[model samples]
Target chain A: MNRVCIVGVGSPSGDDQAGWLTVDALLDLGIRSGDGVVIEKLDRPGSALIPLLRSTAWLIVVDAMQGEGEAGQIQRFDETGWPHYGHGLSSHGLGVIDALMLAGELGSLPPRLDLYGIEIAGTTPGSSPGRAIRAAATRLAAMISDQLASGFSIPPGTQPGYG
Target chain B: MTESLRSVSIHVPVLARVEGEGALDLRIDNGEIAELRLRIFEPPRFFEKFLEGHLYSEIPDMVARICGICPVAYQATAAQALEKLFGVELDPWARDMRRVFYCGEWIQSHSLHIHLLAAPDFFGCSNAIELARIAPEEVRRGLRIQALGNELMDLFGARSVHPVGVRIGGFHAAPALSRIKEMRDKLRAALPEAEALVRWAARIPVPQDDQGFVSVAMRHPDGYAIEQGRIGVSDGARIEAEAFDDHFAEHHEPFSTALFCTYHKRPYLVGPLARLNLNHAQLPEAIKALLAETGLELPSRNLFHSLAARAVEILLALHEALRLLENYRPPDSPWVPVTPRAGVAIGCTEAPRGLLWHRYEMDDDGRVVSARIVPPTSQNQGRIEEDLRLSLLNFGLDQPDDALRLHCEKVIRNYDPCISCATHFLRMRVART
Candidate 1:
C-alpha cells in the first residue's frame, strides 16, 4: 500500500556513502513503510525490485555513483532503454536496469520504476563514508520531503513521484 | 586476439547461471597476458566486518549465508574453527555425520551444475530452459533429481537454499534415524539417474587437457578426505588447512571486487577436477563402477570432465548417505559444550565447488577478532585468467569478435565462479531457528 517503493542500493560502509544516507533521508521525510512508501536496502542492483514493483505504483531506487560528471550530481531517469546491467554502469556485479529487465523477462516486474543515482567521488573502504554523499543526501531529503508534503499529487502510482 | 588486441579488457557483468552476480576481465598487452580478474564485485556486505562483535557460540549460524549452495561446507568449517576455540575435538560419529552432510551438498550442488549449468552449454542452448523445450521429460527428471537432494538437506537444514540444522558444535536437533533411512532408500533410486546424467554429459565432446592440478580438501589416513586434511597440490605444495595463507595471498585489483589468489606463484585449479585428479584413489568402489558404467577413467585432467566426475561423486555421496543412515545414532548431546579462548583457528572443507577455507582470530570471550574467507572461486580466479590467455591461442583471431567473446564467456563459465562468497566475511548476524 506504500505510495512509493524506495529501493535503496549500495554499500553502507564504502566511501560513496550517499546511497545509504539517501534511504535514511527518505525515511526522515516521515515516509513510513506501507504508508504508500516501502523501503528496501539491497547490497547491489538486483531483481529484488520485481516483487516490490508488483504492488506499488511508483518505484524510486537510491544508489551511490562516480560519474564523468561532478560529485553529488543526482542522475534521475526512467530505466526503459537501460540494459538490466546497463552498459558502462560499472558500480557492482549486478546493475539496476538489467535486473528489472530480467524481472520483466521472468514475469516478476512492475511497470513504474525510477532510479535516483547520486554520484559520489570516492569509496571509503573499512570506514564510515565520505562528505559529498552526506550533503547530497541532505538535499535529496529536502527535495523529496517537499514532493511528499504535496501528497505527491501524482496519480496513485502513475508518473512516479516528485510532483 | 592479436598483439594489438592484447591490451584490451573484456568485462562481463552478470557471469550468468552461477550462484550469484560476478564478472571476468582478461588483460592482454602486446600478446602477453597482463592481468586476469575474475572480479567478485557483489558488494561489501560486511560479513567479516561485523563478526567482530559477535560471540563465538554463534559462529555457525552466521557463516551459512556465505553461500546458498554450499551451506553445509560453511557449517562444517565454522564448526571446526570454533571447536579449536572451544577445545572440542569431534567424536567419530560426529565426524561421520558431518561427512554425510557434505555428501549431500556435493550431490545437490554438482547435480545443479551438470544439468542446469554444464549440460546446456554442451547442448547448444542459452539455458536449460531451452533444452527443456526439446526434452521436457529429461528436464523434469533432472529437476526431480535435484529436488531430491534438496529434500535431503531440508531434513537437516529446513530448506534447499540454506539450512538451519547446522551449528557450531553439531546439529541443533539430530535427524531421526528413520529420516536417514528414508533418504537412503530414496537415494538408491536416485543413484542411477545421476549415472544417466553423466553418461549424457560424456557424449557432449568437451575439450580435454592435462592441466596441472591442485586441491585443498580434507584428507584422512584411510582415503580421500571428506573433512580435515592438509592441502595438497600437483607440484608438491602441501600443508595443514591452517597453513593455507602461508603459501597464498589475496590481491585487490581495480578491475574486479573479488580478490584473486595464487599458490606457489602460479594459478592452479580447484573444485571437482582438482578433487578428481588428486583423490581418485579415495573414490568408492560403487563410484568406480559408475565411472566404468559411464565409460570414464580415473584421474581425468580435462576440466570439462568435471561433469563425469560429479556424477561419480554423486554415487559416492548416495553411498555414504546410506552407510551413514545404517550406522546412525543420536549423539548424547546435539552440541558439545564450548569454552571460548584466545586462538586463531583455520578450517577447510571441500565445497561442492571446491575447497572452502575459513580462518578466524577469536578473543578470549569467543568474540571474532578478525576473519578471512577464501572461497573456491577466488582461488580459481587466477586459473580462469590463465585459461583465458591459453584459450586465445586456441581461438584464432581470424574469428569474429562476437564469436570470440562468446567463447571467452564459455571458458569463464566452466569454473562456475561464485562472486558473492568471495566478497563476504564474518561479522556475525545470527538467524534464529
Candidate 2:
C-alpha cells in the first residue's frame, strides 16, 4: 500500500507556526521516513507539492491562516473546489487561483486533497502562535491520524488518487 | 493520393531568452496542439537534498549557484535568516550595502530581461544579436547599465556572481568611504546610459496595461525598501514578513513541476509588476518624472508593461545606488557573531524577481537540518503558465510556426522564469500502435 502524506506548512520564525506546530504530532504518528505515512513540512506551498502529491494517496495540508472568522480557530476543507488560498504567511509572491483552475482545465491535478487551516496573529517568532493555532494544529493532526487509521474514508463522489 | 506530415517535433538543448535548460515537446496531434510540455531537465543540483548536512555558514555561497541572475537575493535571504537565528542585528550601514548589491542585480537582471530576453518580440527578430544589427546604440546603453550594475555589486559584494562579502551577520569587509565615492563616478556615468535604456524601453510596442496583476513588493513608509521591507501587495494587502506564511499557501498539481502559490486564493503577480504596483510611490523624483515624461502609471495590470516597469526599477535602483554609495561608511566591526540556537529562522527578502523566502533548520551544532528556499520563479510558475495560455489565446494564432513560436517565447519571457531553480521536469513516451 502506498503511504499517506501529511505536510505541515509554516515559517519557523512566524508566530503562526500552528501549521508546523502540529508537525511533531504528525511525526509521532508512527510515520517512518519514506514510509507509507510520509510526514513533511514546507516554508511555502510552491511547486514542491508536485512530487509529494504524486507519491501519496492522500495529502493533508496544515498551515496558519488569517482569521477563522474569529481568533483561536481552525478551518478544514477538502480541496475539491477552487484551490484553497490563504494570506498573511511568509509568501509575498503571486496568487495562482485562476492559474490552478486553468491547470485543472489542462487535466493536471492531484485526486485527493484535504487542508487544515488555523488562524494566527503575528508571524514573528519572538511572539507565540496564539493558543488558537497551536491547539488547532494538534487537534487537526490527531483527527487526520484517526481518519488514516480508519482507512481514510472517501467522502462521496470524489475521484480516486494514487496513494 | 495526398498525405500530410501533420506536425514537426522540436527541441532545445538549452532554452535561451528564458532561464534554465529544457527541451520543447511540441507534439501536434493531427494539427491540434496535442501535448505542449516545457520540460526542465536541469538535473536538480539537489540543493535541498544535499544541503542537509552542511553548516549554515556554507549555505549562502553554495545555494547562490542555483541561478546566476539572483545570487545576491539568495545570499541576502540566507544571510538574513542566519542572522535572525543567531540573534544578530545589522546596522543601517550593512543594510545599505546589501541594497547596493541588490541594485546591481536588479539592473543586470532586469536589463537582461528587457533587452536580450524579452526585447526581440517587440521588434521582429530571432534574438538580440539580430536586433543589434538594427539598433546598436540602444543595445549599447543597455549593456552599459548592465555593466555598471555588476561593477557596483563587485565593488560592494566582491563579485556580481555568487558574492563573497555576504556572510552570516554582515559583510566580510566594509567599503571604504573613498571607494564608495569612486562608485559615484561610475553610477553618474551610467545615469545617462540608464536613462537611454529607459527611453528605449518606453519605445517598445507592448500594450500599456494588463488586466489583473498582483505585484508583491516591500512597502516602507520612508521610501522604497530595496533589500529590507515588510510584505506589501498590489491589492492593498500589507502584512509584516512575520505574517507571510499565514497569508500564503501552496498546493501541488500534476501538470507543473513548480508549485502554484495563491494569495487569498486568487492569481496575483510578483516580480517587476508587483514591485512597481506596490512601491511606485517610493520611486525617486527623477524616475517618477521619467514615468511622467514617458506617460506610464503605476498599478498597471498589463504584463507587457512589465518591460517598462523593469526599466523604471533600474532607474530607481541607479538613483538609490548612487545615494547609498554617497552615504557609504565602513563599520568598526564588519560582522557580528551568530551562535546556533537549535531552532529555526525564517527570512523573506525581495529577489529581483519577487519575494524570496527561506526557512532554515539547524541542530545544536548549527548544521542545516533542512532547508526550504522558495525562489520567485516557483511562486510565479503558475502565473507563467496562466499568462502563456492567455498569450496563446490573445494572439489567436493563425501565423506560421516561426511567428507563433516567437509569440510564445515572448509570453514566457514576461515572467522571466528562472527555470533552473524551479523543480526541473521529465519526458514521457507514449506508445501508439
Residue B416 C-alpha lDDT in model 2: 75
Tens digit of per-residue lDDT, candidate 1, span B1-433: 3433534444555554334566655544555446555666666667888677788767777888677678888888888877866778766667777777777787777766666566666667665545555554555555556666667777777655557777666777777777877787888888777667766666767765555545544455676776677777766557787777778888876766677788866677788878777787777776666667667776665666877677667767777777777767877876665677888988887888788888899888889999888888878888877777666656653344455466666676677666432111112121111
DockQ of each: 0.03, 0.01
Highest DockQ: give the candidate number.
1
Q: Which candidate is the best by lDDT?
A: 2
**Which parts of model 1 are misplaced by more than 4 Å?**
A1-163, B1-20, B25-37, B213-216, B420-433
Candidate 2 C-alpha lDDT tens digits along A40-129: 766554322433555455667776666546655777776465335443232222122322232233233445667676777776755666
- Residues A1-163 of candidate 1 have per-residue lDDT tens digits of 3356777777645555676788788778776676567776665533223445655665677777666667787777675544233233333222565445434444334345666778776665567666667778888877766766775444454332110
* TM-score per candidate, chains pooled: 0.68, 0.66
TM-score of chain A of 1: 0.75
